[model samples]
Each structure stands twice: as C-alpha cells, then as structure tokens.
Target: MALKAAGGHGGNVHAAARDLRRPIESLLDFSASVNPLGPSPNVLRALDEGMRLIRHYPDPDSVRLRLILASRWKLAPEQFVIANGSTELIDLIPRALGIRSALIVGPTFSEYGSALHRAGAKDRHVRAARQDGYRPPLEEVVDCFRSGRKNGRRPEAVFLCNPNSPTGQACDQNGLTRLLKEVDRFGAWMVLDETFVEYCHELSQLPSVSRYPRLIVLRSFTKFYALPGLRIGYSVSSARTAALLRQYQPPWSVNVLAQRAAEAAIRDQIHARRSRAYLRRERHRFAKALSSLPGLRLFPSRANFLLLELPKPCRAGAVAAELGRRGLLIRDCSLVPGLTPRTIRVAVRSRNDNNRLVAALAKLLR
Candidate 1:
C-alpha cells in the first residue's frame, strides 16, 4: 500500500524521500514530534526477544500490557483497551459512544474531524486564538455547553488535545476539571488526547479517569517511547465505558512486537527521565535560536515541538517546501484551521539537527 498522508499528520519521510529522490536517512525530520532520544534501550532488547513470538498470534486481549498499565495508573485492568495506535481509538470513540455530534477544541489534530466525519457525525469547533498563544479555550467551551443549542442541539461529545499539536499549548488540570463538570452536566463525553502528555506528565488527566465517568484519556507509546514504528497506544476510561470501546476494535489489532515493546518502554524509567531532561534542554536552546530570526513569532511550548509564524509575504507552505528541498521537513500549519498562513511547526530534535534547521531558517528568512 502506498503510504498516503493522514490529515497532514507529518513524518512522511518515505514520501519526502520518494519526491526528493534521496535516501530517507539524509532527511532531518522535524515534522513529527517524536522523542529525539529514540526508543528505550530495553525496547530494542525486548524486540529481539519478541521476534520468536511472531509465528504465534498476538494476545487479542493484550492482557499483560493492560495489567502493566493498570498497575502504573493504579486502575483496574478492565478500564484499559489497547489498540493499534491512538488513531484507531480516535476512530472508534465516536462510533462506540454513539456520538452523533461533537464540539472539537481546535486548532488541533485533524484526525478528530476526520474520525467524526468517517462516522457520519457532525462536528463544530471552539478554536483558540493565536493572540492567546493558542491555549485551549475551555471557558468558551463551557459557555457553549451551559448556553446549550449550538446549531439547535447540544454536542454529544467534546474532543480536546492537551498539549495540543501544532500550537503546543496545554490547559491545566483545574481548567479540565471545570470543563469536565460542564460536559458531564450536559451529558456529553470528553475525549482527552494525551499523546504528547508524556513530555508534560504533570498535565495529564489519566489519573482522573475514575472520577469522571464521562472522561476518556488516550495515550501512546509512539511519542515519548519513540516507538512510532511499533504502533501501540491505549485508552483509559471507566470499566463500563472501556468495554464499549473494546467491542468496536478489530481482533489482534496490536501486534506481539508492539505489545512487548510498549511493555519494555513503559518500565524503562531511567531512559524516560533522560529523554525528558534532554528535551527540556534542547527545546529551550532551539526555541531561543529560532527566536533570533527576524520577523519570526515563536509561541511558548510545553511539549517537545515549537510553532512559528514566518515574516510577512512568507507562507508556511513555501518555507516548508524550501526546507524540504534542503532535506529538512517541517509541519506547515497554514491549512490547519485557526492558524495563520505563515504558521509552521518543527519538532525539537538533537542539538546538531536543531542548529542546522535554525541556520537554514535564518538564511532563508534573511
């Protein structure tokens, strides 16, 4: 199958290589905001050992992995449902929950809109303004819920990406709690995508899943664990709610290697700590370097990527395309609703790669 771009989600190195007629390794991919440190050393060892299990079918229930997750979050095993990736869970949510309409908090991931559309559901957006640094407007969302009847009826669900992509802005737990209260009062489901939360674990709402029955928290081994190739992610909700999602998932969606890799990745605390420390230092250095470019507007980011606005007359598409020609890929956010035409996003990579991108941007912007 030809790997087509999924809602402009980035990390299309294969496609970029094919288009540029260059080897994949030659590209510096700042498009996908994955861990710069790569996967845990333990995950590599686990994959080697797990190769023997490929002949046998993977655990359809993902029992051991769920048990590990349950232990980590101090939740019941029944409250978790492992999947091929968080994207699978995103597609399943609207279908499983009978969500006919949703209010998406944007500008954020396109998958939410695509997933709802695929489910034949109507959706609307409550976007964060650029002037506000793209912080999720939970207040406006609550007002919409309290006021009721947006387009003649209430939304059955609300989708929010905490530490939201492209913008890299996040909401605090208090804000989420307030929003959840409003959602529950109006009898709506809240799907919180915490894919980027491993970088800012303190902001995660995963531990609050038990308290808010209407809340569902999504996580991934792809980002922090740097196992995007493995395609393992899971969702947490009340046991009853989790059962609903599980019924929609196809059998053996997560492979044995992904399951084993996730298990090893989760247990590697030392590596996790090292990865976080590296991102803190590197993201700061990178942001500072990018800020030096004249006529550039850099948004504050808690996550491992930075969102930028190029100088006037410079479109994100043009900048991204130019950078692509130089074998440096970035996310052009111009088409993403709620962002300006000059908007672009880049991942916080290794020191040398980050510096290379900074120098390239400086030269191009000059």
Candidate 2:
C-alpha cells in the first residue's frame, strides 16, 4: 500500500490488537505519534458534559472554536480557520490558493504532495539528504530560487514542516526567519506546520508567524492533546488568506463534540504544562536509549518523536515487522526518498512503553 494509505494503517488500534491476539483495551500502540499522556481530564469531562448536545450541528461556522484559537494567537476570528483535521486543511491549501506550482520539502508528510497532485499542481521537491541529517538548507533554497528568476518563474506555495517530519529536525528561529523572508520576497506562501511545536517551548514558531504577512501556520489538537479521533486542527494566517480559506469552506467541516473537547483542551493549562514537563524528561531518556543501541543513529528531536537510521543491511520494514509482532508499531520510513531502507521513526510515549521498545530492540539487534 502507498504511504498515504498506510498512514491510517498501523494506528488501527483495535484491528492491530485483533491481529496480535490481544484485547483492544489491552493494547498500547506507539505507532501513532499522539501524545501518550493526553485527551486531558478536562477534555474528557467536556465530552461527557457535551454528549447530550450531539443532535445539533456544530456551531456551523466553528465560530466558538475559531474565536478561542484566534484569541489565543492574538489574532482576529476572521484570521483563523478550523478544519476536521490538519489533513483536511492540508488538502485545502492548494485549492484555497489556486496554486499550480509548489516547492515541497521532502522526507516530510506525504499528504502535501498527494494534495498537490489532486489539485493539479506542478510539484517541485527538494529532497533532504540523509548525509545532512534532514536539516533545511536555507542557502540552497535561496540559490535555487535565484537560479529560476531568469525564467520569470516563482513557486506559488512552499510547504515547510518545522521540526520536520520523519527526520524530526527543526530550524532555529533565525533560520526560519531567513527562509520565510526569502519565500515572502518571491511572493510564495509559507505553509508552516507546527503540529509538533508544543513539545519544544522556546523553539516554537507559532508566535513568530504573527509578524509575517504571507505565512500560514497550521496547528492541531491531535498530536498534542491525543485528539486524533476527534479530527481537530486549525490554521493561523492573515485576514485575507483566512477569509479565502473560509470562502472555499466545506460546511460544518468540524463537528460539535470535537469543537467542545478542543475548546476545553486549549484552556486546560494544567494539562499543557504537565505534558511539556513529561516530554522534556521522557523524550530525553527515550532518545538516549535509542541512540545507545548499536547500529542506530538517533537524530536530535524537538518534537515528541525521534528519527533513526539503522545499521546497513537492516531494513526498516524488518524492524517494524518484528516490533509489530511484539504488539508494538513504529513508522517505517524507507519509502520516503533521501531516507534509506534503514530509517524508521518512533514516538515518545509513557515510560513503560518507551522502555518496552528499547528493550525489545536491544534484544532484536543482538
């Protein structure tokens, strides 16, 4: 199956359970990189309280959620958009902008290219080299743009996932500012995916997007709040871009339960703070354990997941399959170019789960 199809593959929590001969309730999946600690007590309580109102359509406009997100980002309600998930908004981006050409950063999300193709986009991909550990090359990108200037051609959109996916490598604030400035100059829009930024406090680019006119930052409650099932995500951008996205809107795209749960989750400061503390500690321990294993090269991660390169002759599929048989799941990333068959990604979860993964692999690698 294609990587896009496989996305919803390993995370079929119940089905994966059945295959392993375990009760769904007894299984813990590390396949999905969702916050192992979340869907806070507050969000749970709100869902319980709001369960009776499911008959009514969600605030059709997602007015309440947008207002909260807008307020949280110090922007007007008109400058925010709520979608079923970041995936939906990701699909909408090309259509909303009517862009025919895009420059996508690879070894990242597959949806960007899939979405672009569906929108009839002429795709231009700059694959990040494993030799460079998948960090953004600002100068190379600028040079590419400059090289294309004589053709009177410029890309319409640039999809940049900060703390980039699969590799989990992030650019510092200075690097991002320079890249965004270059994209902004060529009249290209920056679609900054900050879904994993909450794991890295000072390094987050959410607040920085406020100062750029053409940058659109996408956020999700799925990864941070463990709300993937609810399908809650939103985007922050200029009033004009936000309005354009809304103008091409899908009606009541987000549901009532998701809206309420997310509204509660966003306000749950206690939960957010505790999650940060947990990731800060557990992620360190987890990364160290993975790196200490012979033949695994663990990259630095500001996100809740780590990107790893295994020793030669060890395929990611073989590793993922072995782990899957043990009732554990990790992302097999070899299909992504620039990543060898040895590449795999693991999510940060509870101590017990993380330890299980480390121990399981230590035995297998031997």
Candidate 3:
C-alpha cells in the first residue's frame, strides 16, 4: 500500500502540479491540513518589519520569540526550545537524550520513525486499530511498554502524536497522565506531538510539561499561523530537557523573519478566535456533507482535517490522480504505515473550497 517513497504528509502543490502543466494557484489543495484563513495580518506586518534585519545574524537564542510563547503558556522562557521547525526538535530529542530504542504509535506522521532512525535508535511502531476509529488505546501502549521491560531492556523513548495525523484521534488526558507516570518509572521520555492541538486547545497537555519532567511537547506555527514557508516551531519541556534540546541545535536555527512572524502570530488573539470559530462550524458542516457521500467512511477528528476510507473496490491513489487532473490535490493515505489503500486524508478548508472538494469527490465517486 506504500504508493510512493515520500510518506503521505501532503500539501505538495508544487510537486502535484509540476507535470500537469497547471498553475499552482489553480490547484485546490485539500491535502495539507493548514489553516485556510491565514498568515495573519499580524504576521504580515512582522515579516515586513523583519526585512530590515535580514543583513544581521538572527539571535541564535530566539529570546524574543520564546518570551512571547512563555507569556501565553505562563511558563518561563527556559522551558521552551525554538527550532527551524518541529521536525528539527523531533530529531533532536532522540539524539539529545541518547535514546537507544523507542516505541511509536502509528499509523501517524512518518517523521517520527524517520527522525528516530536517523538518530540511530530502533523504534517499534505499534499500530492503532482502524476498528477503533484509529485511536491508540492507552492500556495497550502501557502493556507494550511494560512487556518490553521484561527482556531486561526497555525503550528509552515513546512517541505519541496527539490528535494523531492521518487519523485525527487523541488520547484522553487522564490516561496520558497515568501512562506518563509509568514511563517515568522506567526512566523513559514521552514525546507528545501536538502539532494540530491548537485547533482543539482544550485537549492540549502543553501546560503540564512543567509538571512532568519526562514529557516533551512539540508545537508548530506552520499549520495554525499559516507560516509554513517561514518554518518556525517550538518544544515545551522542563527547563533541563529544553536546554539539552537547544544544545544540539545549530546556531540561529530560527531565522529573523521566522522569529518575528511567530512573535506576531502568537499575539494575534482576534485571528486565533476567528480561526477556531470558523474551524468548529465548518468542520461540522463538512463532516455532515462527507458522511452523506456513498461508500465513504469518515473517521472522527478534532483537528482541521478528516481521514476517509473509501469503498472496497476503490483505491486512494487512483482517486487522487483523477482529482489531480482536475486541479484538486488530495493526500493518498495508502502509503502511510498502518493504513489501507482505501484511505485518503483531506484538509478542512473554507466553505467554498470545502464545497468544491465535496462536489469533486462526489462526482468522482459516481
């Protein structure tokens, strides 16, 4: 079911339209789950202001941006580690902690496997069943962790993709808390990737990072703030863990423009409220519409995207290609580990775009 070498993290407008002879602007991308509304006006102003500082080296420490994030979370600046993107910090975690083996809950983002492998760690991917709507069961994960220790060895790290990618299911906080304590007993780290948690802030464990020394929470501005091009994300952990993550990072990993953009983006309360409100209303409307489509099984999601499993006779890659020819790009989830060829993922976008996508999908299904 692995359709291509690159795993199913979509939003590849450039590559999708490259050989189609179609303009990128003409493509309606329901592939990448990013905010349909923005690079906030606040971000635009910050980017413009950052232009004057391009000639100077960015502050390697990212002090100003960290301060802003700290204020929002009510945590000290030392508890946060800024990076080029969450990917950088993801890779850093295994290396910084000298992790030898790890457990990853899948099928979720491929980067966790790739990053851990690159850090020279052996990672066992435990699949979360589709029958359960792709949500990883906490009891199963705890059992696996405990069972592995019976061999006189245990994984040094465990990764959880909150509101997991490809399948937008998340673990309950109390369950996660109990699991965190279990991991603590074995002296292992729990890497909680909440990249899309901003869309559902009430589910976030970001505030608990200070309480759990073994927890490392990864967050990004790329999806929520629409600053993917700028590439700025940060990690939240205890001050000591944050320092270790920072130590391994190259100098000035966050550029001037990215830092400025994040600073402004975090402070844009008006846009944040609007984005959340819009996502809530539109996600419900879109989900209802999608549910009415024949032969499609839509998984529950709290993030700004939905995971769809098509009828048995259909395949996602083929459907994706058909939609692509019509300037609609979607993610074929067949390649993502733990998923079948019938699965595909699409972003929750604007009303018009969502309707267009539904129309296109409906026509193709017919």
Best by the lDDT measure: 1
Candidate 2 segments whose C-alpha is farther than 4 A from its true place:
1-10, 18-21, 208-210
lDDT of 2 by residue, 1-366 (tens): 111112343466766666677776665576668888878998999999889989887887788887888787787888788998888899988998998998888767878888899999988878777777777665666666777787866678888888788678887678778888888888888899888888775676667566778899998989989999999898988888888888776898898999999999999989999998999899999988888999889888888888888787888888877887877777778777667778888889999999999999899888
Worst 10 residues of 2 by lDDT: 1-10
* Poorly placed runs, candidate 3 (over 4 Å): 1-8
lDDT of each: 0.90, 0.81, 0.87
Cα lDDT for residue 93, model 2?
89
Measured with C-alpha atoms, the lDDT of residue 75 in candidate 3 is 96
lDDT of 1 at 153: 70
| lDDT for model 2 | 0.81
Tens digits of per-residue lDDT, candidate 3, 1-366, equal 112324435776777777678888998888888999977898898889899999999999999988989989999999999999898999888889998888898888888888888988899878989888887777777887788778865778889998888788888889988898898887889999999998888989988787779999999998988888888899999999998888899988899999999999999999999999999999999999998999899999989999999887998889888888888778888888788888988899899999998998899888
TM-scores for all candidates: the values are 0.97, 0.94, 0.97
TM-score of 1: 0.97
What lDDT tens digits, residue by residue, belong to model 1 across residues 243-358? 99999999999999999999999999999999999999989988988998999999999899998999999988888888889999998888888898889889999999999999
| Alpha-carbon lDDT of model 1 | 0.90
After TM-score superposition, the amount by which residue 207's alpha carbon in candidate 3 deviates from its true location, in angstroms, is 2.0
Which pairs in model 1 have colliding backbones? none
